[model samples]
Every structure is written in structure tokens, then in C-alpha cells.
Target: MDDAVRLESLAKSYGSGDSAVTALRDIQVSLPKGSFTAVMGPSGSGKSTLLQCAAALDRPSSGRVLIDGTDIAGLSETQLTEFRRESTGFVFQAFNLLPSLTAEQNVALPVRLAGRKPDRRTVQQALAQVGLEKKAGSRPSQLSGGQQQRVAIARALVTRPAVLFADEPTGALDLTTGRELLEVLRKLVDSPADDGLTTVVMVTHDPNVASFADRVLFLADGSLVGELISPTSEAVAARMTELAVPTC
Candidate 1:
């Protein structure tokens, strides 16, 4: 399968000389198109750093980041901004929704920010993808945490990005709500319409959340240590235990 994103000899550091602290070192991994991948590690393991570099949110100190076959490491600020605006989506732990705006309006913000008039139909469809079509008129404060996150997901998908980067997406939800949200994400990967297949790379500390992915990649001290295909919650937890890593 073709890679949605590929990291080659990627390394990121905080400073120079003796004060320098490396967050990622020689990380090499390829996330396939239309696949769901979970990244797991203990605290300060650089999982979020990996997501940022892969999504082009931050530049790596060295090496290359290829997204959908283009080398992003060399793109200029203007070009990179255009590329990210058109091709990538992000969902962080916080909903990042504007409390004053209705869900539909919030989803439309991305398109509007791109200097384009958002198509009402397209925004509604995006919300429908997350099963929040009917709640389009509700504001973030009027909805539950899960619904707000769903709105965030819709906002991310509104641009029809080739890749979606989610950082601890279910971290703020209860067990049932988180599981429901996971199911929504899983279905999107498994079944996409209009060739809207989206490759998902998510960072999470929960075994159950990792189990929702097609594969789980384990990281330790900014290095890829291991991986598991068709992972289950029990198996994932066992491996984390072997690594002596705390889930939280």
C-alpha cells in the first residue's frame, strides 16, 4: 500500500550543544493510506512530537517528512501553509471549539478561514459523518463533551484532508462515550464515500483506545521499539506492562 505519511531519519531537538534535548531520534515509520494507527508510550515518550512532525505542524531538526508522496521538509512557509490548509486535519485533546458558535458554524470556520465560502451542504455532510447532523444548531456549551468533540471531528473532516492527526482524542470522555467516539472513527477508516479515504494517526495512552486501531506502534524515549497488528486491549496492556510503562 502507498504511504499516507513517511518519516525518514527524522529527528527533533529542543536546543543546541550541552543544553540540547532530543525529543525524536532517527524515527522511521510509514502510515498507510486509509489505515488507522495508534501510537502509545509512557509519559514524555515523544508520541505527540511524532504526531506534530508527521502532520507538518512542526519542522524536524533533520531528515524528511513525506506526506502523500511530497517532501514537506523543503516547502517554504507560504507553500507549507497552503499545503497544510488543503491536505491535513487535526483533532487535539481539547475540543478547541468556539463556545459561542453553533456546531455547524464551528465546522464551517475552517473553510471560511481558507478564504472560501463554506458550502452549507458540505458542512452538514461532515457533521453527518460524525452523527451530529441534527445537533448542528447547538452550541458547544449546549452539548455534552462527547458531542463537542464530535463537532471538532467534523471540523477536521470538513476540509476532506488526506491525513487526520488526533492527539489523545478520547482523553476527556467517559468510557462509554469514548468507545462510541472510537467506533465513529473506526467506521470512517473502514468505509469512506466518494474516495474520501482518510489515514488516521492517533496518540493515546489507553489500551482500549489503542485496540481500536488496525495496528499499534510502541515508542520509548523517542524511538520506535515495537509494534502489533490486529491488537486487542488485553494484548496491548500486556505489552505496555512488559515495557514497564504506566498507561497514564
Candidate 2:
């Protein structure tokens, strides 16, 4: 499969002197199209930094980030904005929904912001995929946390982005609700409708959350320390224990 994301010697640092802190060091990783990967790390291990850098939400102090073979670092601000709009989707711990907008409107917002007219049918289908078609007209305040999160997922997928970056997507939900959200996300990654063009990368410290990924990348002290394929919560927890890192 083609690479959906490529990071070459990615580095990020804060401050400029003897006290400088490196959040990422010579990081390199890849995510292939239609694959699902999760990143795990301890507090301050650069998990969030890595996700931000990979998604172009933050620039690395050095190195490169490529999406679909196009180097995002080389793009100008306008071009980068376009690139993100056309190629990337993000789901954060917070629902990030507009309280004033209905679920359907929230899902359609991205396409609308891209200066294209919204396709009502496509928007409806996206919501349906998340089992929220019936609630499409409900406002964020009208839905439960899980239902709201599902709307966020729909918003992320509605754009049909090349890659989706989720940061602790289930962090804010109860176990049952989180599992339901994970199921929706897992289905989206494995969906034939993705057409071999979409990939998923999530940043999570929870082994249960990471268990859903096809692969788990472990980071410690700003570097990739290990990787586990076909990961399970048990396996990830064991590895975290071995690494002396606390498991969630």
C-alpha cells in the first residue's frame, strides 16, 4: 500500500539555549493508506507533539512531513491551508462542535468552508455511517457525550481526507461510550468506502484505546522506542510495564 504519511528525521524543540527542550528527536515513521495506527507514550513523552507535527497543526524545528508523497513543509501558508483542507481531518478529545449548529451542519461545515456548496446527500450519508442520521438536526447540547463525539467523527470523515489524526478521541467518554466511538472509528478505517486513500493515526496513552489500532508505536523521551503489530490491550500493557511506563 502507498504511504499516506511519511516523517523523516522529524525534530521539534522549544527554547533556544542550554535549557532547550527537545520534544521530538530524529523521529521517523510512516502510515500506509487504509491502515490504523496508535501512538502511546508517557506524560511529556512527546505523543501530543508528534501528532501535532504530523498533522501540520505545528511545525517541526527541523525535518520533513509528507502527506501522499507531497512535502507539507515546502508548502506556503496558503498552500498548506489548502493541503490540510483537502488531505487531513482531525478529531480531538473535545468534541469541537459548534454548539449553535446542528449535527448535520457541523458535519457539513468543512466542505462549506472549502468554498464548495454542501452536498446534503453526502452529509446525510456521513451521519448515517455514525448511526446519527436520526439526530442530524439535533444541536450539540441535545446529544449525549457519545452521540456528540459520533458527530465529530462524522465531521472528520465527511471531508474524505487522505488521513485522519485523532488525539485521545475517547479520552472524554465513559468506557461504554468510548468503546462505541472506537467501533465507529474502526469501521471507518476498514470501510471499503475509504477507497484505499484514507489512513488513521491516533495519539492515546490508554492500552485499551491503542488496542484498536493495527499497530502501536511506543515513544519514550521523544523517540520511538518500540512498535507492536496487531496490538491488544494486554500486550501493550505488558510492554508499557517492561518500559517502566505507566499504563492507563
Candidate 3:
């Protein structure tokens, strides 16, 4: 499919009956394949809800989510699990690396958990992609915060997933490290070899972080309010300011 992810009439709610609260509303969007897109919104703007539904990490209360052209809403529980494991990659604010495992082991954890012996070459290539090949033998304890996050990114990319979902991936790092990580992500999306096979979708609150993306989707009050193409930090910050102000 031309779109890596498509959401149609998507909505999400928590609780039910009189106390129900909707987190998303009639969301319709498509992420172009092999492109880098960033999602931005204020607190309670449904950014997190959108990511969870799009990644198949959680089900939407209504509507459909298509990943690689397959409707995830209709998949059985077991099938959904398999589809997610096989089609998606995720990175988050927390590194979430196992403390006892070396970098290589951590990167290969997903494959191993899927009941396959970790492929040596695959592990090596993943680590190398994130420039961590030399530290493959080191445990999380031995790495800096940036290194740990790189390992996390490596793990996410190992499976060659159709899309990589990053939520506040640079939230825990220092400015320099965050920039470095963003560059790594940018290169991944811009590289011709990867561009044909993988797409990247990231959610962040930082204007600077969002600037790296080719396009940025802005959400407010559980709905898409605007979008920015070829965004810059200044532009993003200004748009965020505009979003925060209530419309009469």
C-alpha cells in the first residue's frame, strides 16, 4: 500500500456509560510510505491515543486502522499480536533495556522471544546501524543514556519493520545527544535503501525534535487542527502557540 498507516473515522474512549471520556474523535489520516512524520499536541490532545491505535498497541473504540494495507481491527487477538511483532517497530522515552543483557542481546531480544535463535549477522547489522557495534558486548549499566537509547533504536530496527514508531525518543537525553539521535533517525529515513522499505512516525513535544520530520501533524482537543510541511523549530513553536490559544 502507498500509505504505511491509515486511520479512518477513528475514535477512542475510556470508561463507558455516563462517565465515558473520549480521547480521539473522528480521526482520519494517512501516513505516506517511506516518509518521516511527527505528531505534536499538548497534554490530553489525543497524541498518545493516536499512536497506540495506529501501532496496534491498543484497539480503537471505533473505526479502522490499516497497517500495510491490512485492517488491524478485524484481526484476531493472536493474529494481531503476530502482525504487530512482524510489521512494527517502536522506541519510547524510556530505554527499557534489560539490565543484564549486553547490547547485542538486547537488540536481539525480540527475535529471540519470537522463538528464533538470534541471527549473528542480523544482530551485528542492527548494532552497526546505530553505530554501536563496538559496544555490543557492554551491558546497559556500562552505557551512557544516549548509548542506551541507541541500543533501543537498534532493537526497533532489527526486524526491518514496515514502520518505526518513536514516542519522545529523545526525552531523556541531553541536547547534544538528542540531536545526534535525531540525525540518526533522519539518516535512516533519508537513506535510499531504507526509504524504499521503512517509514518513521514519531511523537514529540519538542519543536526542535519535530523539525527533523518532513511533515508535522498537529492535534488539539482530540482532533487534527493543522499541519506543517518542511517544518522548522521556529515555525513549529509558533504553531504550537497558536494551537494552545482557544478559538472563539
Which residue pairs show backbone clashes in model 3? none
- Angstrom error of the Cα, residue 155, model 2: value is 0.9
Q: Estimate each model's TM-score.
A: 0.96, 0.95, 0.97
Writing each residue's lDDT as its tens digit, candidate 2 over 37-112 gives: 9999878889999999999888899999998888888888998988888789899999999999999999999999
Ranking by TM-score: 3, 1, 2
| Candidate 1 deviant stretches above 4 angstroms | 245-248
Show where candidate 3 strays beyond 4 Å: 192-196
Ranking by lDDT: 1, 3, 2
Superposed Cα deviation of residue 160, candidate 2 (Å): 0.9
Q: Every model's Cα RMSD, please?
A: 2.3, 2.4, 1.2
Worst ten-residue run, lDDT, model 1? 239-248
Instruction: Please give, for residues 112-204, the per-residue lDDT of candidate 1 as tens digits.
Output: 999999999999999998999999999998999999999999999999998988999999999999999999899889988475687889999
Reference-based lDDT, each prediction: 0.92, 0.90, 0.92
User: How far does residue 128 in candidate 3 sit from its true spot (Å)?
Assistant: 1.4
Task: Give per-residue CA lDDT, model 3, range 67-146, as digits (tens).
Answer: 99999978999999888887899999999999999999999999988888888888888888788999999999999999
